[model samples]
Structure formats: structure tokens, C-alpha cells
Target: MKNLLKNGLMLLTGILMLATSCNQISDSESGGNGKIVLSLTDAPFPVSLVDKALVTIDKIEIRSTATVSSTTEVTTNSELFTVLYDGDPMEFDLLDLQNGITTELLSMDIAAGSYDLIRMHVTNASVLLKDGSNFDLKVPSGFASGLKIKMTPNLVIESGVESEVILDFDVSKSFVVQGNMKAKNGIKGFIFKPVLRATCQKYSGSVGGKVFENATTPIAEAHVQIIAADTILSSALTDAAGNYHMIGLPTGSYKVVCEKDGYTPVTVDPVVVKAREKTTLDIQMATATVTVNP
Candidate 1:
């Protein structure tokens, strides 16, 4: 009888353990699948003139969609993806030009679902030329356009999967003309026209420096402006490291200027923007001296 009781207890314990293991296996397979990733690639082109600078982009807009199971609950719209320019603001509308496919920027993160088509729009950012001898150039507001893009055979997003889409185009074949030249009659004929081209090359760099207290130690939150000729191209704030990145600029010359309260402004000249290059410019701010007369 003692042996039988011991055997019964052991059998019960083994059965319980087996039941627990089976339950765990079912739970492991019950949870929904993982997220889907969509990537976009742009077509190659020759460097084209924009604002008198050569530029090229590798990719445009990217978007994704996913179908949720009845068991899955979506808590927020944040999962819906969007695109943003390097220095531009975030775009929310999937149909708007600013968020469309023509831009070098692309969207990321779309859950698994059934999507009919991923739409994209591409257009050039408009440039406005300021009058006078200086010829200051400015990018006007609301100048982007969305050209429609349709992908065939609707993309499928499976749970726990990723996908990629290509937005390819050739730039060497694409060209645009601007400006006119003087003719033999000297009546302002079209002779020297500016042709814009696009090419893929190494076009990346950085600009940074220090804002100091009497040339010692770094200062934080100092305003830095990158100027190209008469134009203020970009700006950044110095961090605790007294560093900043002047990004998304075309090949050209620039000047770095730093300003802060209770300090004299400092300027660094001839900051060049080059293709596939990184340029560093550092500046030191001077303490302001006050003159008081009684």
C-alpha cells in the first residue's frame, strides 16, 4: 500500500507538469505576429542645379499598411507612418505633396495589413530670387507638389515580416533649363543658360565650433548661423559640447556666425560646402565690455 501511494503521487505530479507545458506552448503560438517593415529606394541621377547648386537624391517617400486580427487592438494612430525632409517639418497627410513620393525623404514603420496601393508624389522645391545686386535666393513657402504614384498588385504586409519598394528613376536623362545669354545683336539673347543636372556622389559634411567664456571652456545654447554669401542657409544651437551640425546644404561657400547674450558675436568665414565632404568650422565668442560714464 505504501508503494502504491508513492507511485500515485508521482504520476499525478508528472501529469500536472505535462499539462502546464502544453498550456505554455499554446500561449506561445497564440500571440499575434511581429511588425512589418517597408523600405524605399530612389533612382540615380546626375547632380542638378537647384539654387545654383548641384544636388541629387537617392530615395523618395515610403509607406506601409497592415491588417489587424480581431484579437489585435490598435491603441494609437502613431503607428501610421509619414515622411520628413532632412531639415523640414514632419508631414502627416499621406496624400499631401510635402509627404509624397518625389521627396528624398521616406516614411517608416507600417503594421501588417492588406494595402491596395502605396501612393507617392514628387516635385521640386521652388526657389525665389530676391531682387537687387546681391541676388539673394530663398525657398518660397507652399511650393511642393504631389505627383501621383501607384504600385501595381497591391503590397501585402504579413505579420512579423518586412518588405521593400523601389522608387527608381534616372537623372542623367532628365534636364531643365533656366536663364538667357546675350546674342550677337547684344539685345539680351539666350546664350549662357543654366542647365540643372543630377548626379549621385558623396555629399555629406559637418560644421561645428566652440562658444567660449574669454576663450576658455565651452558655452551652451549659443546661436550659430551658417551664411552663404548674402543668404543665411542654416542655423543651430551649441550643445554642452559646443558642437553643431550644419546639414542638408548644397555645395557652396558658407560663413559661420555665433551670437549670445552678454557676449560679442563671433564670425568664421569661408565655410565651404562640398560633395561627399565634411567641413568643420569652430568659433570662439568674446566677452562683452561695457562702458559707463558718470
Candidate 2:
């Protein structure tokens, strides 16, 4: 996805929202075992300069809280986690998955239980510019211990049921660009600090709409946010077409805020989002500076 920047600041936030469909064929399993599908998606990045951002993941690991007979002692270290993907090292071009797009990486059947932690072992990462110059990104401590992400509320897999977890890797926040991107030899390098947000498909919903000014002109790069109880749940910027979409949001009533530097921010209240459904909330933002129409 294209992440547009303003005044050297990253304003576009991406969501790794789960797709409604799974590409991988589900395993035919009966009772006791639950199937979990893991998917990867990237938030927006600067598409004008960066050609491709590559991330190599060795494997994925999950920690389940299910105990044997409620008497087994829970191990707190690596032993508590199970390998979700370890067959072959998977490399993904994060730019390929953007703007409500996602790729199913793994589908596996495991014992039904509650999982609280998920980790991804990164083997390598790099960034390629449109000019063909590439630089290797530094993955801090990601190779040995992996990037650990703890779920706020543990994910539960039911018996004989299929579930999905969408990992939104916000590339805008993860890859910190060094030097001035607009100056000559500006991009010295990039530091890779992967930020992943997990959302379960069971209780997640979606919101999408177009941001326009005066209900006529589509406004690109406008920041749209979903707010609930004064907390910012999710945020994203309008694409080139002035459309914004946020998925994998928990079902609830949210206040949708649309804002840009030159336009007056608009907030729509009680924008209800239903589970597994999409709510369309088109926003019309007024111009901050009045047009005199001389």
C-alpha cells in the first residue's frame, strides 16, 4: 500500500486486516483439534522511492495456555511455544500486500485452547529503492529470540472450528528511515523494528469509505481514525483515490474522524460496526481556509 507522507512525517497507518477468504485448503479434521490460519499484511509505505521491502521469516511460534488436566505446570520459556511455521524460510514483499489485501501464510490444526503470545523469527530484511540501490536492514535481536507479540485478550480456538489471526505489520512505523529522504544521498539506511498488531476474526469488523471535501473533491492522504471511549482504536490514511478502509476492528460504535492539514477535521458519531461486516462511512471535510472565490 502507498503510505503518503507530509512534512517528513509518516501519517498513513496500515491495518493488517484479515481477508474474508482463505487461499489455503483447510484440513479435514473432526473434534478436539482446531484449525488456525495465520496471515501477513503490511501497512502503507512510501511507494515513490521504495521499490520493494523484503522480510524473511524463518518460522512462526505460538504459546498456548491450555494445560493438561489443569494440573500440569505451565512452562514460561521457549518450551511453552509451539512452532506454527518451520518448513521453509518465507520471504514476503510487504508492498505486495496493501490496501485491504492479505496473504494466508500458514494453516494448521492444533489442540483447542487459548493462545496469548505469537512470535515471528526474522532471518533477514532489506529495502530496495526505485533507483535499484538496495540496503540491508538491521533486525535487532529478531534472529535469535524472535519478535514476541502478546495478545491483549488471549485468542481462543474452539474444537472442530476454524479461526484466523491477522497480523498487521505497520511498515510505516516499523522501518525508520535515516537521513533526509528528499535530499541527495538522504536515505542513509533503515532500521527494522517490526511492529505487529494482531486481530482475531471471530469478533472483528470493518469500516470503509471515501474522504472528500465539500462532498465533491476526493481528498488523498487524509487521516481517518476510529475512536471508541476516547481511545484511538485504528487509523489509516486515504489512498490516492481518496478511499480509506480499516478492518479487523472489534464490533462496537465508534466515532470516525477524518482530518488533513488543509481541511477541517470531521467526526461522524455512532458509526456502528458489526462483526464480520463492513460499515460504510463517507466523510465530508470542510476546508480550513475559506475560499474567497475572487
Candidate 3:
């Protein structure tokens, strides 16, 4: 998935939404333990000049909350997140995660309840600039707080069943460039402000389409983005053939946008994608000439 960016002193924003899915529960065990398998994936972000973006994750934390009620009163209990993986932190370059590829994170079995929050702790971050130089990116107080993503509604796990979750961390949008590019140790390095959530693929579908300049001319390398409720759901870059696809989106209505420099942006609203299905929405852009005063 790719992030769309605007140039100059304008505001910059990148948002990646999460999709969660699970398999059907069997009748063999109606009241047994459930399973949760965690994984990491990311949508495409725009490539302006930066070459590589990498992050190191040392730990992950998850919490489960259960509600109980009896004749006397009602009570709620929450299980704190434990150390699921204790090995050294692994570095990942999120730019290579396009085309729906994924890396395994963790898997565990827990009681039937709701998993509300997830936190990923990082020790260091760095980026490879286009100038053949690598620099350490700063976290900006993320060392103490790490990166936190809240599941407001929470994810429920039933007994005797299994669920697979994919955390789509939008690394392109998670990076915030502050001050001058030469100011590395002086608050200029990219800040790791992650935007992510948990989702399942079994309950989601994909959207595909082509971006073109005209009916016969396909627009290659354009950025296609899907937005729902003003939030960026998925992003992609058009291939050499001017084709773009957004995978693992839940069934809902969204607006599709195709944008390229020196071309008029096109947005098509109300594009819907159903579960386990693929929806196609095409876009055509017109050339725009901009005049800068001398």
C-alpha cells in the first residue's frame, strides 16, 4: 500500500487502516480455548525520493478483557499483555511489503474474551536516503511509550475456534519529517509515529482498478488511494501498465482517488467491496498545467 503526499509547506498525512478476519468455528468443541495468530503487513506508500524505511520491533503486548455477571453483581477482568516474543528486535523495511506480502509475528492461545489494545516497542529506527547514505531515525519519546494502537471496540475470541490477525502498519505515513534534512541529531530525523490496527483477512476482500490519462492511455506510476469516512483505508501505486489494487479491505463503501503529478486528480466515491470478493473501479485523469510566478 502507498501513501499519497502533497508538496511544499502543506500539511502531510498518511493513514493505514487494519482489516481482521477469522475462520468458521467447528462444533466439536463449543466451550474450549481459542487461538490467535498475529502477523505484520503494510500497504504501499508513495516514493518521492527516499529509498528505504526500516524499523526494529523488540516486543509486542496484547490485552484481553472479559465481562462476567451473576445474580449478585457484575464484574469485568482484563488480562495484561505478556512477553510473547523475547528475542532480539528484528528490523523490517516496510517498503518491500507491497503486493500483499506478510511476515509472521506471533501466535498464542488464550481464554475466550476481548483483546482490546496492542503495543509494539522499538529500540531503534533508521532510513536509507536516496544519496547512498544511511541515517538513524529518531523515535521522539517513543522509547518510553513505544507505539500504541487502541482497539476501541475490541476483538472477541470464542472457545474452540481460531482467528488470524494482520497488523497493517503504514510505515510510509508513520514517518514524520521535521526541520531540515541535514539536521539528523537536531530533531530532523524521521519520527516513528505509527498508525495501525489489527485486522483479519478471512473477513475482508480486495479492490482493483486501472488509472489512466485517457481511455486508451494508462497512467503509469500514479498513486491510487481508498478512503472511508475521511480515513485512508488502503493505498497502491500503479504498475507499469497503469493498474492498481487494494487488498484486505472489509465490505463497505469507499472513495477511490487517482493522483499523479502534473495531472488532475480523480476521485470516485461509493465504490464498494464485498467479503471474499474483488471490486473494480477505474479512474481517468486530465493533464494540468501549473504556472509559477517568477
Candidate 4:
């Protein structure tokens, strides 16, 4: 698979849809085809041993919902259009594209309508250990079917309007190891189970704050999660100062959860993040009571 992406014949056949473009059009220009753009972003996945998580994406697909009053639309599940991302397959380190940075996936003109689904083809995934060793991040299945990420709110492409969607690739939750730890590769090997969410810049916000064991002790390496509607939006690891931040969350009511080894977990509920804004939620973990047998 590595050879297929790196030096394969993909370049000759790879369709170049749209390059990095900052496109804007007036309400008048938004007809015929609406400009659609996609950017790749990631959420935190904290691990001690794994140094780098490199993932490769080959193609992108889209299925639209008919919103135009006059035009006919396809509502069938099998109806999918390949959004052109013409280029050599790109390998990205999930850890690097965090906080705020992102890479453009594609920008092209598509028939104006509302899109219900966006799928990404992750051709390959591999990890680099801290010790400079590397291995293929095995995928049990789903690559052929594509990583199906549902746009909770349908993505509308108005005539002459520019629409953009950001894929919040959660690396921490996406990659999983199965089976017994007693084995060599851990769970049948490193499985790339992708976890992703679609959010638009117009509707997303960020969450950040410091965590504490109490009023005095800062909690480092704490797992901080931001969840909305029972779904985890993003997660981060508290730094040395117990500071953590989760970005690219679709604006909504959410809860912040803080957890660490040997400490009691805490959740701060009713934390609201407005569009294009940041919400701060501080947390404190009570120590777990220890039982001793004399």
C-alpha cells in the first residue's frame, strides 16, 4: 500500500479537484455550482510511547441532499460523488495538525445543494515509535467502504456561495489496539479505526482551561474531554501546568471531563461554547479513597 501511494500510478490517474484556494463570492455569484472546500484538522490523542501517527488519505466522496426547490436531487445512499482532491497521496502526522493549524484537502465547484454525507478514504496509516521504529497501522476494515462521517447538520451549498467544512480527525480515539497485550503488536496489531466529525468554521468554537488535583496541585497528563449531546467533540492532555485545550468543536452545549490515573474523575457540565468563540472550564479531581487492610 505504501508503494501504491508513494510511487504508484496514482499521480497519472489522481484527479486534481481544487487546490488551496481562499474563495469568496457574492450572493449573485452563488449559482450553477457552489464552491465547496475542505480542510483537514485534528484533535489531541495523548500517548506516552507513540511519537508520531502518520496517516494517508487518498480520495474524498460526497453525497448531497436535494434542497433546491426547482431541481431534482438524488436521495439514495448509493449516490456518491468523488470530490476531486487531485494530488499525490499525502501523509500527515496527526499530532502536528493540532490546536489551530490545518491543511486544505480540496476546493472545487459542485452543484448547489445540501450534502448529507462526506467520506474520506484513508489509504494507509503507520506509526513511528519514540525509539525510531515504525510499523504499518493495520486497518481491519472500512477503508474500502470509506470512513463515513455524517454531517449532523446538512452542509448546504448555495448557488454562487462558498461552503467549507472541516474534518475534525480525532486521532486519539480513531486508532485502537485490540486483543491481548501479551501479544507482540498488541490487539491483533495496530488498527486504524477512524473517528471523525464534520464542522464548519461558522459554527465551531474552542474549549480550554487548567486542571487541578485540588486548589494547589496542578494535574499533568490529565485527559480532558469536551462532549456535547453525549458525543465527545474533542480531547486534550493537560500540560505540565495542568492546562488543556480542545479546538474545532461545533458550537453547542457541552461538558468538560477531567481524568487522570490515581485520581477521581470530574465533569463540568453545562459548559456552553458559542460560534467562533472560546469557553474556559476549570476542573479539580478529588483523590480516590484508598482502602488498606491492616
Candidate 5:
């Protein structure tokens, strides 16, 4: 009788252990979703000429490939696309977001998986010049279809993790000048062709510092660029405070150059950057000397 009781207890214990293991497996597979924190940033714009650059975004969407149960409806574009945000249109001045600064656009919970692309719908765009003149910028196809940007390295969201994504608007490249800046009526107008890039914060690094002519004199409106293999990776202009910042760089060594109209350009090579790290590099430039003919 004692043997029978002992065997029964053992069987019950084994069953309970098995049930606990099964529950753990279920939780690990589908316990919860991940989160995404989206933000906007801009490369240095020519603040000396352009006073303000504005853009209004109405909707945002993401493309994922993970086979998870979702309530997202199949859009005409693709079934793998999901609407991350669709609400009030938010307008932002690109000039205000620079020098390592950013403005949060949206934040939401997303399924744990891999996302490859992001599309942003732009409703309005305009530019104001320092001369008190403004013009409504035209957005070709972006008004209807949205501006599509592919992720450089595919974004991976793990269960219960919060990921940060930054959308960088390149102002200098997007706005093409129609006329010469020095000639009267030289500045006819500008054509708007939106150029944007996306980066994941966890896998990228940043570099920033002050550009100066001397220890106390800051050089404003100076161009700072990062170069690799004779190509420019990214660039920024010094603010009034002589500060410039370049973000979303992959982990590697880069050559940095700082130049202005009147000052001699300075170059620093092999500046190493690591993931999630910020490298500080302050540069001092001297005035360019002109050669006089005898």
C-alpha cells in the first residue's frame, strides 16, 4: 500500500513539472510585444541663407516580415506593411532640429520582429529666407504616395525592448537653388526634392564639438564633414555658438574636415567611433593668406 502511494505522488509531481515547463515556453514565444520610439533630426542647413524649413507629416508606416498574429489590414501597397501612426498632422522646422538635437514624432508598441522600411506622408512643405521672403515648396509624389526610406541595417525588435529610430533630413541636398546667390535676382527660388535617411540608435555613434578661430572666438557657419575612402559620409554646419554635430555613423574610423570661406580648412584622420558612443573633437582654423602679385 505504501509503495502504491509513493508511486502516485511521483506521477503527480512529474505532471506538475511538465505543466510549468509548457507555460514557460508559451510565455517566451508570445509573452508581449516590443516598442518603437521614433524621432526626427536634420543635417546642418544653411542657416545663413535659409531662415526656416518646415514640413508636416500626417502618417507613418512600417514594413515587417516576421510571421506574428497582427490586426493590421492588408494595404494596397503590401500585406506586410503596418500602420504605426495615423492621426493629426505634425509640423516641424528642420532648422530647429540640429546639432545632436531631435524631436520625438511617435512612440508605440510593435510586434517583436524585423522591420525593413519606413514611409512618411508629407502634407505640406515650405522655406523662409533670411531676406523676409518665403515660398511654398513642392513635394513630388510625396504628397500622395509618401516618402519611402529603407533601413541601412534592418531593425530588429526583441520582446519587450524599446528601440529608438531617427529620421535625418538632409536640407542642403534636398533644396536645389534656382539662381546665383550673389547676383541680384540671383536667388530666383528653390526646388524641393526631399532627401532623407534613417538610422537605429543602438547601432550607431555620433561626433560633435566646437569650431573656432582661436580659444575664445567661435567660427559660425563653418562646414564640418566626415569622409571615408574619398567620399563624404555626413556633414554639418556650425551653429551661432560654433557647435556642430554629426550623428548616426556606423562604428568605424573616419576623416573629419572643417572649412569655411575665409579660414584655412583643417583635417583630422583616423577618428575612431564605437557603438552608442559620442566622440568630441574641437578644431581651430586659421585665416587663409592671399598671395599678392609683384
Candidate 6:
């Protein structure tokens, strides 16, 4: 009876030990792995504007590989992961450039790894520019030449984790310039057909009884007009402190006129504006009464 009891106890202890060892191994296998991520960002250059243009861009390719010289050993395929652009799935080509070369974006759940050599091939691009007349040919001086960015590269991706990469290229500077009127011509010619541009800035100053009499305090919401020749430009209303801005006008001499409900109309001297520049004009309306004789 004593021998049987001892045998039964030994059997129970062996089963418990085996179950514990199996659980430990399973946990180690499940939790010991890591991951990699890869991505591409922004375009390389600006878009070109020429006499006439039209274009479109299609696809881009990239290759990633591990390095033996380095300590980390990254040997895993991540072809199952996704590649996207502007939040869209972008098509790509995965190729082994050489024998024994694992050339592809890789993501693996392993202890940890290192990598090298991320090659890129940008392809499937298209561009289009409509008729030359579509562009505002009178572009400002010092405007930057346009270049199109085609493709960018994806360096590395650590899986079970997040990472970032950039892809971009530049298209040559070429855009249409269409317009009968050109700035290089003489001032009279350009001025006659000048590109209209105007800008305004606000100023605040208190108007005392000298400008408007009989009023306990200054009035608000005055009307301001900028007149050039027969053409009248911007008009604005004053705020609590009497400030306003009018923008986008052609270069010329302008008369500033200010009027309020209880104040006399005020007109300032002609303000001259240069091309592609802003001119400032402020006015204070005086108070006066008009009497009609029958």
C-alpha cells in the first residue's frame, strides 16, 4: 500500500511539470517576435507651367535588402504588407536584382534585425497641361520655375510597429506664357493694359471736435472710396476705431473720398500707386450743415 501511494504521487508531479514546461515554451514563441514598417512621403519638385502643357504620372518601384557587413541580420519577406500613396494603394514591382539577393520590402516577427540597401525605381508617371491661354501669362518677376516631383523611396519598415519614408522626383521647369500684353514693354504700353492689383491697410486715429463739431463723441461706420480716373476702386466701412483695408487694384493715381451720415464729405489729394505695390490713404471727414433757400 505504501509503495502504491508513492507511485501515484510521483505520477501527478511529473504531469504538472510537463504542463508548465509546455506553457513556457508556447509563451516564448508567441511573445519573442518584432516587426518592421516602410513608407514614402512628398514630391521632389514643383509643377511646371509653360507655353502649353499636359501630363500624368502612374507607378513607382522600390527594393530593400539586408547587409552582411552589419551586425543585424534582416532576412524576412514583407510582400504581404501594403504600399500606399496619398492614402491610395500604389502598384509596385518586387524583383531580386541578383542571385542570393532577397530584394523586397520586409516585415518579420522575430527577435530583432538590421538591414541595408533600399533601392528605388519610380515609374508610371503622366502629366497634362491644357491650352496656353489657360495660364495667367503675366506672372510676377522672381517667380520660381516649376518642376514636377515624380517618385520617392521607402527605406525601411519595422513590423508590429509604425515607420515613415519619403518618395519624390522633379519634373523639368516648362510652362506656357500666353498674353498679348507683356511687362517687358514700355510703361505706357503696360500701363494701358496693366494687370490690376490693389491692397489696403487699416489705421486708427481719434477724430476730435475739430473734424466733426457738435458731436459728444466720434461717430463710427464711415464710408471710404478710392477713385482713379472715371473708374472707382475699393470701398470700405470703418470699425469702432475707424480702420479698413481694400486690396487688388491697378497701378495709378487715386483720389480718396470719405463720408459719414452726419459728417461732411472729405477728399484727399491724388495718391500714386506703383506696379505690384500697396498705397496707403487715410481720411477724416468734417461736419457741416446744408441749408436750402426757397
Question: Ranking under TM-score, best-scoring first?
Answer: 5, 2, 3, 4, 1, 6
State in Å the error of residue 285, model 5: 0.7
The C-alpha lDDT values of all candidates are 0.34, 0.69, 0.62, 0.62, 0.69, 0.28
lDDT of 3 by residue, 190-213 (tens): 666666645555576778878888
- Residue range 125-238, candidate 6, lDDT tens digits: 222232323322232222111111111111223334322221111012112122332245311211111111101111111111122222444445565556666444434445
Residues 129-202 of candidate 2 have per-residue lDDT tens digits of: 89888999777853367777667577777778778777767776677788788798778888876766677766
TM-score of each: 0.36, 0.78, 0.76, 0.74, 0.83, 0.27
Residue 63 in model 3: shift from native, Å? 0.5
> What's model 4's lDDT at 66?
47
Cα shift from native, residue 153, model 6 (Å): 43
Which runs of model 4 end up more than 4 angstroms from their true locations?
A: 1-34, 67-82, 99-101, 106-111, 159-162, 179-188, 213-217, 286-289
Q: Report the C-alpha lDDT of model 1 over 98-168, residue by residue, as the tens digit.
A: 00123323434444444432222222222211221122222222212222233333344444543333222
Which 10-residue window of candidate 4 scores lowest in summed lDDT?
1-10
Distance from true location, Cα of 131 in model 2, Å: 3.2
Query: What overall lDDT, based on C-alpha atoms, would model 1 receive against the true structure?
Result: 0.34
- Pairs in clash, predicted candidate 5: none
Off by over 4 Å in 2: 1-31, 67-76, 182-185, 214-216, 228-232, 287-294
Clashing pairs in 2: none
State which candidate, 4 or 5, has the greater TM-score.
Answer: 5
lDDT at 143, model 5: 34
Model 6 RMSD, rounded to 1 decimal: 29.2
Q: Judge candidate 5 at residue 291 and give its lDDT.
A: 88
lDDT of 5 at 243: 91
